[model samples]
Target: MNFFTIKTSWSNAEFILIKLCMASAYILIGSCFHDFFENHYSVLIGVFIITAIWFVYQWLKKMKSHSDIPY
Candidate 1:
């Protein structure tokens, strides 16, 4: 399925399941890297920075695309 397509038929249970799975995956990955980092606090800070930059980048890209359309 395409990432941009809207699913009108998804139920609340399915949505919750998806969210739970994603959270589980994130925790698992973070735990895997916990041993490698000397300082756990820095890892969190780095994740925050990277996530913020990615969010801004996606927002700007979406805005640019919207601007290209004639109103």
Candidate 2:
């Protein structure tokens, strides 16, 4: 629980930059493997997996910060 002792805050610009960087990495990977995701089903599955991962991350973060509240 005390693994990370340093607490740092990111500005809006920093958050935006981080998101842009992550998006760029995704785009680069997608372009490099264009053939693998050419089919509609593959694209759908990729989107679903990404959405599920994001949902889980948000749920965990919320639970950690607000343990008393049930969502």
Candidate 3:
């Protein structure tokens, strides 16, 4: 499976499951690094903000790719 390519064949349930798993994984990672951030709230917030931006960028790219392909 291609990590950068969003599969069009996933069912609604499968898509939702994947989303939930990703979210949980992100949260788990943040928790693991909580001490590494020195418990600084601002730094933690910045990390989450960057993550959100990355997700949005990827989503937009995926949408564009899908649009360019003829179904």
Cα lDDT computed for each candidate against the true fold: 0.54, 0.54, 0.59
lDDT of 3 by residue, 1-63 (tens): 355665544356545534654665566577676765445655545655666666666666666
lDDT, model 2: 0.54
As for candidate 3, its clashing pairs are none
Error of 2 at 46 (Å): 0.3
lDDT, candidate 1, at 7: 27
For all predicted structures, in order, the TM-scores are 0.43, 0.40, 0.45
Clash count (model 1, backbone only) = 0
| Per-residue C-alpha lDDT of model 2 across residues 1-71, encoded as one tens digit per residue | 34355334445654553454466457546756786644555555455566556655654665466555443
Q: Model 3 TM-score?
A: 0.45
CA shift of 1, model 1, Å: 33
Go through the candidates in order and give the C-alpha RMSD of each one to the true structure.
Answer: 10.4, 10.8, 9.4
Task: Return the lDDT, model 2, position 15.
Answer: 53
